[model samples]
Target chain A: MGRQLLSILLLAPLAAILVSLASRRARIAEYATVAAAIIDLAVSIPLLLRTLSGSLIFAHGYVLLDAFGVWVILCVSIVYALSSIYAVGYMRLLNEEERLPTFYALFSGFALTMLLACVMNNAGVFWIAIELTTLVSTFLVGFEREAESTEAAWKYIVVVSGGISLALLGTVLFYWGSSFVLGPSYAMTWAALRQSAPQVYPPLLLVSFLLVLVGYGTKAGLAPMHTWLPDAHSESPAPVSAMLSGALLNASMLGIARFLGVVTGTSVSRFAHAAVVGFGIFSFVLAILFIVRQTGIKRLMAYSSVEHIGVQALGLGFGGPLGMAGALYHMLNHSLNKSLMFYGAGNAMRAYRSKEIKSIRHVLKVFPVSGILWLLGAVGIAGAPPFALFLSEFTVLRAGIGGSYRWVVIVFVIFLIIVFIGFLSHFRAMYFDEAPEGEIVPLPFTAWRTLPMWLAFLPLLVLGLWWPHGLWNIFHQVFLSVMGGGQ
Target chain B: MFLAHINSLQASIFSSLAILSLLLTFVMLGSHWLKNYVYAFAAQSWLIAALSASVGYFSGYRELYAIAVLTALFRGLVLPWLLMRIVSRLNVKREIHSVLQSSSSLVIGACVVMFAFVIANHMSRQQQGAAHVVILALTIMLSMKFLGFLMLSVRDEAVSQILALLVLENGIFLGSQILVPGMPLLIEIVILFDLLIVVACFGMLVRFLVVHAGTTSSRELNRLVG
Candidate 1:
């Protein structure tokens, strides 16, 4: 049953790619992708529920459907579904009817690679999957074919490919280290690495882990290495930006988390955690600085992505059940909330014919219902209460408070307030500030545009209000599987 | 472990091939012409393929022969061919905009090699017997990586950047051949094909860069900023 669901979950996107490519009309291609994304989301939820009871291995152990991996799959599928629906409304605005088929094809292909990256069991194969994601998404990032878009695409591929080669090297080192214990011919599976971790030389293991962290951290948009992100995210069409933030970063984080799991109980574990914490804090501080002085609206959201990814890294580096749970929860919430924010930003960009926040004024006058939802989303994403991010961020903070990095918790809280102020100030200007003596023309309302925001906003509100018991159970099981104490 | 069991002739053969490949990376770093970078890359790929086949022969890993053939066909031949096509399409021949002089960059590249050697020396100290070959492999692998990044930072042309990325992948591939020859055959093969797809994608993007951006040099492509 689990295998069937996994097959369907993967095959749906493959089928969508074929159908989209075969179709001549833009509407058919768009609808086909939306259908595929919905099917994937439907399949992934059950897969996540089923895998929580026990991990499943398939295809000679090259694919793993464990609780931790399935949770990431769930996040990817959610973003895929939301973004595809949002893309239907968003791409129509681009007026490139002839190229829409190709766009949808690459979009589904990008989704397929992120999903593939989630379930890959072999570390080497996982690197390939992540690399494939970069390859596919570079086209998507450059889909607009503008000067800036192509430049962003160039930087995205170069930086990410260079960064992940470090990950490839680290994986080789890991396999070499394990070879000393498991012979020269063993599979480089996550389980094999974990089994051989304690026996590998401490210095080798530490160096390998740090290399992998920096490599995957670059992909996941951690600071200092996040130079490509604002350019790529802000320059891509909005739905693609949504998917890049909402799906792709989480997949890369899955790689880092799994690697952390392998070295969890080793002698280098403390140093490993501290290094993660250091990167996390650095990313957080850097993002805060950028956000405060940000100009472009989507770039604001991009930097916020860096900030939240930092928080998730902080959670994972904290290394307990609570920390893991909070990080996983933050992944889902950030996906939903970031997608909502990008959709609104896309809508405003189309209506006002500008990408600057200063140009978009009186949002309630323009969008009315969805505008209110966007405003609330901005508040929610700023780590305000009655929204899901606040809950997850608070949980991550609680996880840090009693730990060795309690000082990081204090730093985390202070910046949380700063981020709250900095992020919402842009929204405040957009929503409440008067326009500079100009009549802003609003675009005609489409359910395609606002429906996903409503879909995303409702869940963000509910998940904040009620943290589900089933979710707690799933998080606990994933924590056990990732941190290595349960069967 | 594979290195420990190999005889001195095997070790020397591996060491020389590895050093030659590392020298090719230096040729890439020191040259001003984009064609030289591509040629150096092709030579380095061929040398790594030779290294892979030799490692397979000495270590008795038969699958690496297949890997060697693929690396030669794809990395040594097809990738450079594709990159050469990208270069010929562009009007710029030599790196017209230099972030650093070739002489200075080559000096920095030497320093990077020494730095990689120190790290490799530290890492290989943990291993027993035949440690020098492991150290050599690790050093070449890492130096290529550093030199690749150096090329990326110093050269503004799109083709040069693409070659730098290929150099990075070559470094990893060369290291994996020596250090983990028994890594799954499927993975190595897929990564080879994956590299082909990457270059093809880069080829298309370079076309897009030329058409849409009007310049392939990143110095002119800087429209998007925070």
Candidate 2:
């Protein structure tokens, strides 16, 4: 059953993507995504239950049948399933006969790459998978096919391609350094590299950490190199923007976690930790500045992505159990809140044909469900109490302050406050003003569109309210694995 | 010190030739005609390819020799030839408008070269034979970046910007070969593939700019600025 499920998990999305290409209508392709997602979830369910029973499943050398990847893959598949259902309702409203099908095709293809990036055993293949995510998403950024979107696509293409190139270079460099350890057995697999890492050249490893930090961190949209984030996120389709903010960024973070694990070993771990923390503080500072100045609703959310990613980076930089858990938890919450924000943006624009903050007035009046979701999303991201983001974010901040990184905690609090004020101003105007003049009628609001959002949000609610049994242990194993936990 | 001298001498000759091509950045600022700018770019590539060949021959790295020849053929000849056709057929005159003053840009070019030389000197002290090579190559990269930035700053011509960008890419390939030798063949091939596709994309972008905007200038691209 495990072997069969693994093949299905790998092949199902590719099959859906291939079928999506031979047609103009997306109904069949969207259904295929839903089917694939459900099947994948079903397949992963057993892995989760078995992991709980203290048994591990391994597919290939690189593919570890561990609790960490199983949980990530399962969560990704579930969210994807929900998003697929929503896409059916979403695409029914689009008039681009040729493009809508292509959109669905790329969407499914993105799911395949993300899932592959999740479960792949070799860290090198994992980097390639992350690069594939950018390559596929470039089209999604320019789906509107306008000049502005073209510029946005170029921004995404150039920055991300440049970033990933550095990552590839870093991976190869690591191979050169690690070849000293595994000799002819060097496979570029995570397990091998970690096991043989003590012999890893320290100076060379330092350089590798720098390269990976800049490379993967750029994709993760850390500041100083995150110039492309706002343009690409704000310009892409709402759902695509949601996925980018939600899952893609997390995937890149996972790449960084792997880099830290391999490079640091059990020793000082100083270089990787210092560099990531610096990047985190820098991102937090810049995200607040950009968020306040932004006029586009989607751009505001993109900058928010930068800020939240900073929290995750801070957690990883700290490298303690609490910090690691908080970082992982924030990954889940970020996907939920950011995707929800973009859905509201999508629905708002569908009704108003504009993303301008001033033009999207009275969202609640026109699309009641999306309006409330948008409000909740805004509140959540601003780290308002009771929302899931508040919990994860608070833990991150607590970790920082408790660890005596007072500066990081202070800067974080300040940035969160600035973004909160900015969101309030925009959120107030969006819900209270007169219905946008000349707002479009008959926008698509399929019940399926709401499923992914709800699925994403549900975990946030559950995690925030109660400490789920076994989650902590899974988090511990994953964290330790990153910190070279268990051999 | 003897080993260092040889490296410095090698780097000096290459950098001097590179500085000679820094003239092209000025030409970009001062020149009016698109033809002259493309000519300046062509001359820069020719110098770059030649310099790369000499560096490879001196270092005895045969693969770099192959890369150098490829650089000369594709960048020196192919890219310039392509740009010539793109401009002449597009019917845009050679006397294109620019963003900064030719004199000022020339000054900036000199500064960038100075910075590159200093950086090259410091960098050369680290690697056995490749330090000067690395520094000059990095300067060439900065020069390319400066040239592209200048184009982006002043002129609104999308075609010119894209052309300058390809030239800039030539500078990057030049540097990468010098600082990072012994890389896996796969990476080398991937970089080459990436550069080729990017150039083709630039070509397509130029064609589209001409078709849709009626001119390849960014002034016409004012449709999306915010």
Candidate 3:
């Protein structure tokens, strides 16, 4: 049953890609896309339920399904579903219906590659899947066919492909490092590799993990390796931008987390922890610095992504039940809040006909619903109460202090405060400032367009105030998986 | 006894081919003509294919031979043809626009090769079975990978950047030859497929740049900044 559902989740998108491509009408392609997303969400919910009951491993270890993998699939499908709906209004507003086939095709392909990256059992296949995500999204990034968009796509493809190739080298080295212990029977399968990791040579494993960290870390928008993040995130269409931030980064992080999971019992884990923690803190600092200076609203959201990704990496690196669980939980919260923010930014872009935060003013007066949602999203992502992000960030902070990383915790808090202030100041100018002189702006709002934002934001509110038992149980299992305890 | 003799014969051929390919990479790095760059890359791919075939002969792994054929078909012939078409489509004059003079670039390349040799020596001391030469191949690829990086940063043409990325991938492939000769065929296929897609995308990007911006130099791509 699990295998059947897995096949559906993986293959449905491919089928949609084909059907969308063959269709001539934009409406047909859009409907196909939304249907595929619905199928994805429908299939994954049951899969998550089953995974919570017990882990599912199939194809002789090619695909492993635990609560964590299911949780990621659920997040990805939810975002993709919302994005598909939002893309309807976004494309029609721009009158880009002629390009719908290509957009929908690549969108489906992008979602498929991300899903594959989450569940693939082999490290080599996982790396390939992540690389494929870049390939698909590059075209989507360049969908505007404008000079800046094309340039952004070019930079994104070149930088990310280069990074993933390094990760590929690391995967090869990992296979070599473990061949001594595993006797070359299983190749690079994660389950087999993890079983043999304890006996693998520490030097070789350390080298592989470092390479993997830098390699996948680039995809995850880790600082110092994230030069492409802002450009790609801001240039792509809003739906693509949302998926890149919300789903794709998490997929790459999942790859890194799994590698760390494999190395948990080994001596090299300390090395991995230090690297993750260092990169996380560095990214957080850089994000705060960049956030304060950004004028483009999408670019601001992109920097915030870097900062939140840093938080997750730091949580994972903190390496305890509280930290790891909080990291996983934060992944969920960050995906929801960040995607919602991008949708808001999209609304602002449509209304102002520009992405510059300084261009448009009186957002609250012009489009009250989107304006409120946008402001609330900013407050929500800033780690305010009544949002899941606040709970997750607090949990992570507690874990860090409890784990005796006092200095790091202090810096973390300082950076968080700075970023929170950064968010408020940037949006304050956008929301309350007067409009540019004699400039008239048209309002582009509809119930259908704004519905997805409210749909996504409600969960953030619900998850923040209430932690249901089933959800907590699943989070506990995922934490155990991260700690290398559960299957 | 027969197998032993065949192994030595195979080893000599492999060594000679690897060395020749390494030498051709220098020609690639120093060439001022884009056509020469393409030819040098194609020749290097052919040599890698031959070397893989010999590795198969010596190790008795049939999959390596298939890898060799795929390399010849895709890297050696198809990719070069695709690149040549892109060159003509862009109407690129046969001139390389690099930041450094030829003499200095060549000198830097030589220094990098020596640096790679030293690292390879250190690594080979801990491994086995002519793996030192393999590591030598690996380091040469690494240095050339740096050369690719140099080309990317120093050259003005978008096509040069594309060729430089191909150089980086070739370096990675060469390193894999020595690092894990027993890598799965499935992985090799996927890597090749990825290369094909990247090339296609690179060609499309170059064409787009030329059509829209009237130049293929990435230096003009500065509209997006902090």
The backbone clash count of each candidate, in order, is 0, 13, 0
Compose the digit string of candidate 3's lDDT tens values, residues A224-243: 98989999999999999999
DockQ of each: 0.82, 0.12, 0.43
Give one digit per residue, the lDDT tens place, for model 1 in A56-157.
999999999998888999999998999999999989989999999999999999999999999999999999999999999999999999988999999999
User: Candidate 2: where is the Cα deviation over 4 Å?
Assistant: A1-7, A37-80, A113-132, A159-212, A262-272, A433-445, A485-487, B1-97, B113-180, B201-226
In angstroms, the error of model 1 at A420 is: 0.8
Best by TM-score: 1
DockQ for model 1 equals: 0.82
Q: Higher DockQ: candidate 2 or 3?
A: 3
Question: Ranking under DockQ, best-scoring first?
Answer: 1, 3, 2
lDDT of 1 by residue, B30-69 (tens): 8889899889999999998999999999889999999999
Best by DockQ: 1
Model 1, C-alpha of A370: deviation from truth (Å): 0.7
- Name the runs in model 3 displaced over 4 angstroms: B1-15, B94-97, B110-131
